[model samples]
Target: MSKAEIQTTGFFTEREFTCWRERDYKNFYPCQVSKQEGNYVSLSLGDMSYRFDDTIAEDIARCILDADLVTAGKLYGYIPKPAMRESAFDSWYKMNSSGVWNYFGEGEFSYYRSGGVIIFMERVTDEDDTAEIMGIYTIDDVGIKLVLESSSYSFSKLDAVWLSNALMEALGEEPLDFLKTSTM
Candidate 1:
């Protein structure tokens, strides 16, 4: 067995390079962002040598465009923030470690379609060792649930995997796996 080397090259700023390195899991993930002819940007993720398909690359580009549009308040319904997990965990931690002693425990989350409504289901354990299931209703029925696996504050690999899968399923396509392994 051998360890993979990590390196980056391109017209990337320090902040952009840092963000890309943080998102790299195996210590070697290449992130390329190029400006296209129009109001579009081209992005790629993986080892520098890996050749991504044009269609998949286009999908990535489109996802970026849609996200920019959504963030600019031009799109409606569920326009998920790129750092949703981070945001979620931040709120979770804040609620857990406030002026009082409340721990955000863990449980399961499931989502599906029913009656033309998009619903979010969550089960979380509180400080008192009690589990509660909560439901979230959204304007658009995306038919996906964002589940919080554990509330122990120490996030696990399984939690990360599940969240990744859930979010990809919701996004209709596998997004560029760009996230750092950090709480909040």
Candidate 2:
């Protein structure tokens, strides 16, 4: 039997959205392009779902940032080679979060803190390309920040595609081509 080296505590992945239904002010949704409405972003995970106007770029950023880790871990778990998980860990840890900007439309950023998990999403109001992502470390109030560990642009891009598709699949829906654009 394979043992999970990663300890289980209050930490959760985006896939664990089902278990968070009872929690107040907590979100477990995934990001996706919406088909029911034009220029909208649909975030769906398990049975819980949220739809937002494309104009709310900050919300979209939160969804994307929040789901990145879970998606990366899932991808690493699927590789066929030995020690692949470790490789994924190293690659993920090597990513730099310096340029990351979580612009929340000129001081409109928000965070969700619950069950030892913290997600920070900020977006610059004028800049369309920059967003900041900050997440709490999975220990007992050590106050460690999760650094971006995406080794390369390709890695980040791959993870984004996986996230978009995973969210769509989890919703029992087909993936759409273009996600709604936002400027928040």
Candidate 3:
């Protein structure tokens, strides 16, 4: 069985949105990388989705800064509301909170979703990228799950495609067909 690792303790990827509700603050919802062009990006977070397109800015999309997350040019998809799931730790808010409210450090949380997602993207061997270990998870006060391929995840076909693309994004290179999955 594979083991899961804790990449963070809180929701690091979630940004404060004007359309967010109270309950939608905690926990991380799985997201699919629907699209990722030069200056355009899109993600499907089940109940809701996010898209960024800086037509005026070229390669600056990847140069996403903290301030850009909230003030950047964004487009809310799927119902214009955040998915329902209260977060135990709102790292985004906490990290940005006043010195008194900055309870958690930035690395303590993840920004990938599910509080923040921990993506296992290690090359199996140092020789090449042919064999690799890959997994996605969330770790918070709930405890940590650290292992490789220890759990089974059911993914949709579209999800598989997008996740593969996401893995590539994680690697900062070409996407790979690493995640073998089944349709939901």
Q: TM-score of each candidate?
A: 0.21, 0.24, 0.23
Residue runs of model 1 more than 4 Å from their true location after superposition: 1-30, 33-50, 74-184
List model 3 lDDT by residue over 1-184, tens digit each: 1111112321112222111122244433354443232443443444444332322111111111211222211212111122333322122323223222111101111122233332322223344333323222212211111112223232223333344445335334454434433333
Poorly placed runs, candidate 3 (over 4 Å): 1-32, 36-38, 52-137, 140-164, 167-173
lDDT of each: 0.27, 0.31, 0.27
In terms of lDDT, the poorest run of 10 residues in model 1 is: 135-144
What tens digits encode model 2's per-residue C-alpha lDDT throughout 152-180?
A: 11123233434445444333345432443
Point to the candidate with the largest TM-score.
2
Off by over 4 Å in 2: 1-33, 57-160, 164-184
Q: Top model by lDDT, which number?
A: 2
> What lDDT is obtained when candidate 3 is compared to the true structure?
0.27
Ranking by TM-score: 2, 3, 1
* Rank list by lDDT: 2, 3, 1
